[model samples]
Target chain A: MDYYDIVMDSCSFPSGFEHALGFKRVFVSGRDFEPANTDKGEDAKGRLAIGHSSKNLLHAARRFAVAVVPMNLGLDRAFIETLRENSTILIIPLSVTYGASSDFALSTNMHLASKMLAYANKRKVRVGFATMARSFEHMESYMQLIELAKLIGASEDEARQGISLAGDLFGK
Target chain B: MKTKFRYVLVRSTTSLGTIDEHEFSKGLMHYIGATNYFKANPRVVKNIDGNSFIMKVSLSGYSALIVALALMKHVSGKECGFFTIYASGTLKALGKHIGTPGTETHSKSSNDVDNFANNNNI
Candidate 1:
């Protein structure tokens, strides 16, 4: 019954994250956008990293527990292999939902997410859903977040597990 | 003929005030599209507070409407978050959900629907 959320450190929720939102733990990170190729951070225990390139994606898979797919990802066999090897949790963040400025942007985000999700399904990659909120408006209720995972092509069961699975790796 | 509908409980940011219906429809149209908007045709049934409200929409358009509600990030130029708390088939049930713990308030026009239809309006 205890749900968890992963958000950017910049996100300011109301005083009680648990009482107000129902999330038992909320993981925070300022350097989630750190490139997968860099050694900028010493630890990747529960940190998120951007998989901007195929080369860096394979490398980032090993370095970060969660590789956030911020852009329209074009996955290859080798990338999937590397991600599976590292047991990396591919994250489909809510920033993609809130950041879409227009219908075009929304469709773009959904299309990319659908493709990523399909790959996750075919390859059995552990995926997570997070708010990654940049502002108060960027956050959503747990149900809404799960609905969003469905919006981007996750089934009812897949969406629920994806959200909780991401939390399992980071949340205490 | 009776028309089936769903009541949605929504919670927004504390700063958000009573939402103008037209502006709300316009913001939601961008996400659900004009056709789905007509299918959903959501109307504010009650304002629980500055941060929360109850809405009613046709049952057929429930899914698209929920997605639109979640996608709505700002309203009337103020940054806000709209969270759909609970959705139920009856206003009395929705009322109990928000903990008024009082008399059951059911709009006969919506419940029995009498002669009303989903497409009767312009």
Candidate 2:
């Protein structure tokens, strides 16, 4: 099965990187909001936005075709259900976690990522895992992504599906 | 029962140059800790190319190693990223994907790593 990773814009991937990374497609996000690969046939109605707050996330979901909320804290069942209602997605991004320069930062980031993931799974929220890498150093291969997914408590099958969720967001 | 290891085929953005198994072990230990390191028993089997290599890690350490590989942003001050291409139970099985003419035998470090892991397990 094919897998995808959403990355921030770069000049371009290295030669043969797509094949080397084992991803059928790598969509680039032009900004922190909606990535450039999103279905653009629809105009402003489908703009993608990323929000950090429940209210802001809900607002973005209603204002745009797609709304992304980073999962970094303990979330209540009600808030997640409300996000599901608005069709918002919660994402655990590697960019935020891997930049940790200290052990404490890395541990904290890992705990938050895992907590968010476990909660999202329990809530059956549409959750995603992506590199969201702004640089090649931050980007990971499809298999590595799957491995990380498993590290964070996802089954092998669930991990594969999580990586592809970003592609689904791009409307592929 | 003999201890088995999973061989991981990986590629890097930049040439690894002189970086060896010891360096990989240190980096991984920093992330997963020495305990998980023994569980993983990761050894750099050999460099398939300047940028790609085969790694031998225990199944228990596979996930942690992968995450450590991703978490590692640099080596000796040079920026790089490691991408896992494939993994298999045996070196013979992994060599088929590496496209080498024949299976590469286990390196000395591989044997040492296995003994170390076996000793620790016991």
Candidate 3:
């Protein structure tokens, strides 16, 4: 079953969106940093937790079958290992930065992303890459991203599935 | 031994209005030349619209052709970006979806186009 762990934004609960997307469950994170005025609740279909750092995200990972993480923060081995030990699927958002600022950024490193997937595969952890192509360069970045994923561990079919999954989740 | 190739449908967006087709083609070749992906020039598939076109590129085990198309930044001395509208393992699927062929005389060589479009990558 498809699952999501969307970081909460200020003007919305994100709970309703989970229903709209037809996901089995949507775990809302980054809410611990929000003001107390924000609503909180949990039921059989959805759950809202106080998530402020990588630790909280790992805590949530323990409960769900899959964990969705922002790549910037989830790249740490500790965070990845937490989910890996639980056998939780790791769905990482893959964003490729370009131009002057991106030359030194680790987030845009295709080789790094590929190695992470390979590591996950070696540990028997199910992993997925979520990508959104905002421009042509971003599209190229995604091509590199998926190709690298295949080079490391993911098969061609798995790479295609990752692309389709990203399109469905982000409407890219 | 035979080599298999992949065909990519790249949709370009430009800031300087309609770009010259020849320049666009040349820019792509130049951009690919800078990368270690492929050493040869890819075949230019006919342009479907002012901004979108198709190209046949050699498949070298990975999505190198698509990756090259994605990295293109400038064509004809103007800034531009190429977005992938659709990528498939078959030309028939792309032709059916885009409602256009690789050539203007599409009706005559529809079979040939289908044959050429049949690449093993998606």
Candidate 4:
């Protein structure tokens, strides 16, 4: 049985988890924020609070073989190294909020994808980029997806297929 | 070492409305002044084209983002405009100062800039 670890913001996990039970395991992750368990000193307010609290739902879903995905906002080398060590299938879901609407975000996503691809390729691991279902209506999201696919050296057909698969999997 | 910049001036060639280099310099300076990293005086020089010129401004390593953001803000929605940036060292130092990504030093040379520019496509 294959598990589809849906990487997303903490706020969006409940809905995704509800739909993802057919998979072997449903993993929920927070986007652009560290797991609360990992950071002790930081204040958890607003999004951070939500991200920290979302893990509570994971306990309820544990009977259904659901798991909380570990997330970290630290963009340092240590974070990348930790990712390499974990070696789990990494799913990065781009969100519509925050910096995603800007050109800077587009370029940053491409850069990040390339780096992840390089790391994963060397380790024989699989990494995927997912444009959140919420962002399907935005042209910039599609454009960023295409750009990310190209930067990660996915064939055009592969890129299209990946996006199509994601839409089918999560789109309302 | 003082850094020199080659720049092009863009304006409405047919319209009577005009802006002097001093005005441009002051506008850029005022924008930079809002940030904590930029402190040096900007030297503006006219290009061969009357409407275009280059302004040289010095800033600390941490101010690159400020410059990039300022440039992006300034050039947005303008026609006949061109801008380029060059950095002397790693972005990690700057990232550290800004309390962001501090450990990684990704390349920021012409190739990366070109890739970014080509991706953005004006």
Which parts of model 4 are misplaced by more than 4 Å? Answer: A1-81, A95-99, A133-148, A155-172, B1-122
Q: Give me the displacement of residue B44 in model 2, in angstroms.
A: 1.1
DockQ of each model vs. true complex? 0.31, 0.40, 0.18, 0.02
Ranking by lDDT: 2, 1, 3, 4
Encode model 2's per-residue lDDT on A108-142: one tens digit a residue: 87787787788878877777788777787788888
Pairs of colliding residues, candidate 3? none
lDDT of 4 at A37: 34
| Deviation (Å) of A57 in candidate 1 | 3.5
Better of 3 and 4 by DockQ: 3
In candidate 2, stretches whose alpha carbon ends up further than 4 angstroms from where it belongs are A31-45, A51-55, A69-79, B18-21, B99-122
Error of 3 at B46 (Å): 1.0
- Two-chain complex of model 4, DockQ on C-alpha atoms against the true structure: 0.02
lDDT of 3 at A46: 19
Report the poorest 10 consecutive residues by lDDT, candidate 4 chain A. A65-74
Model 4 residue A158 distance off true place after TM-score fit, in angstroms:
6.6
Candidate 1, residue B83: Cα displacement in angstroms equals 1.0
TM-score for all models, in order of appearance: 0.79, 0.79, 0.57, 0.29
Q: What is the lDDT of residue B6 in candidate 4?
A: 24
Candidate 3 Cα outliers beyond 4 Å, as residue runs? A1-53, A62-66, A97-100, A104-108, A133-148, A151-153, A161-172, B1-5, B15-38, B72-81, B85-94, B100-122
Candidate 2 DockQ category? acceptable
In model 3, how large is the Cα lDDT of residue A161?
60
